[model samples]
Target: MDEIVVGIDVGTTKVCTLVGRVEEDNSIRIIGVGIEPSEGIKKGAIVDLGAAAQAIANSVERAEHTSGVEITSALVSLASANVASVNSRGKVGVSGGIVDDYDVIRALEDARTIAIPGDRELIHVIQRGFVVDGQDGVRAPIGMHGYRLEVEAHIITALAASVENLRQSVASAGVEVAQFVLNPLASAEVVLTETDRQMGCVVCDIGGGTTDLAIYVDGDVWHTMVLAVGGNHVTTDIAHGLRLPIAQAEEIKKQYGHAIRAEVGLEEYFTIRPFGEDEPVQINRQELAHIIEARVEEIFSLTLQEIKRSGYDGLLPAGMILTGGTSALPGIRKLASKVMGMPVRTAKPENLVGLVDRLDSPAYSTSVGLLHWALSMSAQDLAPPRRRRMKGESNMNLDAIKNFFKRLLP
Candidate 1:
């Protein structure tokens, strides 16, 4: 039997779950998937515990049915607006000629020793690169002669209360939390390649209530940020601009909104019923597209400003890859390309079995990436035990290592 792992994406607009099995060759087979309308979340933060738990339960149940497997735990994506990241460096000395895994742990511990005030928790530690002795960019230093080992990493942090609340909500759904993967990092795993990162690329995940941005350079994440504005804001702008009910406005935006007005004809019109009016009113499609285009321009402008602030403007040879639900808006790529002055394309999850057709859309990238991430982590966890048995060494204590890393934070 294949070992199964589950991935849960809790977003402001939706909650999605994916079940995947790890193959012998380390590839992932997506066996089940589920999505449900989200409640109790605003701008990616859980506002009401009860509502969020119910949403998680609903999605998890659907995924279990589709996969025909029981899921007790999941690796979740963390995309709360409160999350932030900082870069840090650390160095350690290797006692023996060989650089073992323990030396790697010590280096990471040194990097995480920076002072952080109360109410913040370490979220993720991204390994940027390693320097062995005087040589840099060494991917692995194990079994190599090196007295000094240096590591540069980005330590992501988030509000402790918010994380605790999310954990409680998931536990309420009766699921064990295996790990939390950064949302944009997960998106990058599915959409970006080494060459794209080396050439500098920005991944914009335009979710329901938040837009998560991750800038990559030289095959490493340079910066990460989350904007509290997203598709929900567009819906609000349309509803307020068009004098329609919120539900009706969302329906109109989904069905008719376009991000570029130049492609729409001036005489093309659509009808929408006002909140109180019984008869539907006809409006020019260009007018609607113009409104949407304005908001989209503002979004891309802000995103450009963020990239500029990172000092990566004119450096991104690969330009940008847009994903998430908002990217599905018609002509969004054109609008983004025009405003950002760079090549823009939509990103989708690429590899999957049984659901390749369904997972081809950009909106499902994060969910699919989460599945891949869970499987990768599981494989890493299982490697040491198998290695020890082959080498006739004592059974390696994996749980101890996990606990050590966990305790290094708080």
Candidate 2:
């Protein structure tokens, strides 16, 4: 089907809208791409709906102008900030003496039965793998004979208010919310190879507002997290340390930021006028690297901490894959390797075919990946044909559910 699909990545620093045309050969041709500076959003949460909606509209209009296709509905890449995850299992008896689609559906439904808080909304229920009877790791169990079937799934949830606010902003831009795909999951769709995933690895998407983490074990997501720290924090550090404007600090960080200070030379210098300064100050390049390295180290440190928290830090034989805007900084992968004590590499989308010059960057990983993810889900017909009765519930929908529910609850 030659369908036109759109994906809008609503980031804290930028809003990127991409329009792609699915060809007969199944290749997605990038017809349009629009990226605009984000406003009314902080830390991936919509703080001002009117301003955020205007930004979305601006991005969407640009894409429409370039592609000549009016977008009515689109998939969104959601930030993982305040996201919660858990692995769940569901089992059902085989019907008609064999495991069929209905049986598989029932198993998935059973897996999704978890105690979700009233303030949280379920976004994704991903099947990690399956089991037939007592045998495990069944990728496809349909048509297999078994008295019982079980499914292991990775469930992702987001704050309900956050999701609704984002939807309202997108609606103001005149686009219906087709689905909300997690940023890390979308990025993983295109960046992570089958071998990388099977061998086990971690994906760190260091964006402007938050550092998103995804750990893959046995070729499926084992853990997901969004840290309230990222590239913007690094910029803020530079701004404060150097006494420069946030914009200028950001620009210099893009030009000279490095994660390894030892590699920088003391003789190298960059002239910049600190905020409220009449004259420019010649600052040592190594000093700038020092400031940048401090924050970069923290980002990687937190990422490693999360991996260890997942109980799979030592299982990642494939090491870590770094992407996102912040991952583009120089010496990032090397620093990652040093900090995490594992092999590390920077990556971007490699599977998309079209006007791909801009999309082939770590920053656009989520934006381009959403195209592949959204279309794949559509083709798979992800929603079940019917719903079954839920099993016993427990408060396992998010990360502890202690603070989130307590704050929102009366």
Candidate 3:
């Protein structure tokens, strides 16, 4: 039987659910998609539990109706402002004078034993690299002759309350939360290339209420952060500046907004009925662009500050790969490049098949990337050499080992 994978992306602006089928050649066919406008979510956190749960349930129902598959459990995407990360190192003595899977796992386990607050919940422990004995920069320590093994890991955590709230929302929709994958990490699975990772790059996903940042160096995650501002801030600016309704402001921003004001012609205009106006008024495209440029520039400025704070600012030679709904704005890439002083490119879900007509935009990167994450996880579980074990331990069951080691990896 073909493997089935599901992913749910609950964002500030929308909730998306996707059902995918794994093909013989390891490609995924997206058989189902459900996208609905969000409510009771602010800056990627749930504000109203009932409303958030209802929104998620609606999205799930739509996906189930479209795909004819009963949804039970799925990997969900998370993007809360409470997200934070740290770097730690661990070392372990190699059993039997040789580094093996268990040795590597032990090192990672040790690295994960850092001091965390009572309210913080551990999310991910990604292996940055490994060092065997006196040797450093060892990509894989398995099978190498070494007495000691050390591993460097990047640990991500969030507020325990926020995580439980999200979990409850998904549960209310009748779906079990298989795992919670960070937003930018999930999006990275689809938009990033192997060369991009090895050469050092950042994945900047600017969604409605949050700008998710993930720095990848040496083919591994090095830093991650979530800024509390996003595209919706620009819309809010427009709403206040033009005295228009929030809905109308968002519409105008999407239709006429440009990241760079000078790039827009002064003569170009659009009509909108502001809150106090009796009839429609003519608004210059340049005027709208001006409002957008201010907010957009601030967004990148904040992003630049974060990159520098991570101390990896000088490391991103490959520049940034931009994705998410807000990235679709006109001239955002150009503006981001100018603000950050790096090469920027906008990306989306590509080379997709089956019910993917509406998913080609950058907005669905997280939704599509979730399926890819699931595929990778499934591959790891089905890998060979599963029977190999250390001489002392023979009591571990297959499921126990699978769960234990899977948590050790990303």
Best by lDDT: 3
Each prediction's whole-model lDDT (CA): 0.81, 0.84, 0.90
Q: Cα RMSD (Å) between model 3 and the true structure?
A: 3.1
lDDT of 1 by residue, 42-112 (tens): 99899999999999999989889999988888988888779988888879998775666667677877888
For model 3, which pairs clash?
none
Q: Give candidate 1 regions above 4 Å deviation.
A: 356-358, 382-410
RMSD of each: 3.8, 7.1, 3.1
What TM-score, computed on C-alpha atoms, does each candidate reach? 0.91, 0.92, 0.95
Query: How close to the true structure is residue 22 of candidate 3, measured as C-alpha lDDT?
Result: 95
lDDT per residue as tens, model 3, 1-410: 66899999999999999999999999999888899989889999999999999999999999998998999999999998999999999899886887767777778889999998999888888888888887888875666899989988899999999999999999999999888889999999899999999999999999999999999998889999999999999999999999998998999999898999999997998999988789999999999999999999999999999999999999999999999999999999999999999999999999999999899899999999999988877766633243448565655444444433434443
Relative to the true structure, candidate 1 reaches a TM of 0.91
Model 3, 195: alpha-carbon shift in Å?
0.5
* Candidate 2 per-residue C-alpha lDDT over 96-160 given as tens digits, one digit per residue, 9 for 90 to 100: 66765667667777888888899998888777788998999877676688999998878889999
In Å, residue 3's CA in model 1 sits off its true spot by 1.0
lDDT of 3: 0.90
